[model samples]
Target: LQEYGLVSYHSLNLLKTQALALGLPPADLRSIKARYSFAWNDQGIKYLGITLPGKFEDIVSTNHKKVFAETKSLLLRWRLVRLSWLGRAAAVKMTILPKLLYVFRMLPVPVPKPLLNVVHRDISSYIWNGKRPRIPFKVLSAPLEDEGLKFPQILAYHKAAAIASLSESLLIHQPLWTYIQSIALPGHSFPGLLFTPSKSRPPLPTALQITRWSQNVMTNTYSPGPMPHNTVGGS
Candidate 1:
């Protein structure tokens, strides 16, 4: 169990180390892709077509605005009916529906192994079968960390598309979109939010010091003590 505790929790420790190295209030560059168009020739990137206006704000301004507006109106009506009971909570939570939609738009979908393999084979065939020389390994190896071995743009598009497609797919499988309601929405209570700079211990839990002393004490106490004082003074 102790060994399991160390290795099993390596990632947790790694994340802490990374967070500490990053210093306090970790630096994150909120991608501006959603609200603003990149200088790159977006039209030239044919693969990115499926996800144009890709910035977080661009979706709300263009794609999700209609859904948000309609839902806001409907929620407003619902609030009017029960304002005395749930107005404030509804206003705080429901008002962020559009933002929630934008964030959900970023979730990566879980692609099954067989289907993803097929897609990889398809992409490889499409690239390698062309009459021209194949794209160099440098291009193909751009996203080594990601499974698809696609360029960043393609990776982002696939991730976003996976989220979009899966959300729709779940509805297709279940119909009624009822299951979507259970999906977690971002909140202060999320585990990611509770995270602080790695070097600092969180104040909420009582101060529990993790130290070598405990391990030393455990090892010494559990070990056989001085061979039980040698009954006959010999083996």
Candidate 2:
């Protein structure tokens, strides 16, 4: 059976030689489009719907644009049908938010404040059908038992996904991605870094982003106080 996979290597000549040794056809090797840090014209490759190796901010921005465009197009089509406000809210929850939520879970990066503001505004406009809103967004986002529509809160969802990703990394059997990220975090353990001051933490973006997110989760969920710590052994 013939199987194909992406090959990443530091040298094209070495890669070609290895591929030839593995019985891969020379023609297939020649046809492969290679991307690397130095490729001026090559954007990152897309895998599982994400464009990799690009600036995190740029990737999040691109995702937001695509999601926004798709959402607007969907809302435009839905406008042709006579849906009530509750129906429209349900559509937004069912259709629109899921798209962004997928991106949120996949990327697990902080969405820029301006982009978030734009998303909230666009969702508001789409849900209200360009009319003045009769209900406040906060009330709309509350549960139905609280006399609300149970609208999805985009920012809150994003934060939850990021915090979940961070928690996953802390598991005793760390994931491959967590192990890879630890290389960037040299000398400091993940738990140790959690207790470290913001200025003292390593300069890894994902670590810092997740730390801030975890802090935000704690701040919102509890009263402010110095976090208690236990030292097991003397250093």
TM-score of 2: 0.67
lDDT per residue as tens, model 2, 1-235:
0122334433343322311112237675345524222222234446577655434457665776677677777787888888788888888888888888888888776667677777787778767888989899989988989997678887788777766776776688877777766676677676565445554555656545655565455334433245454321111
189, model 1: CA deviation in Å? Answer: 1.1
Q: What would the C-alpha RMSD of candidate 2 be, to one decimal place?
A: 8.4
Top candidate on TM-score is 2
TM-score, model 1 to reference? 0.21
Candidate 2 global lDDT: 0.64
RMSD of each: 27.8, 8.4
Measured against the true structure, the TM-scores of the candidates, in listed sequence, are 0.21, 0.67
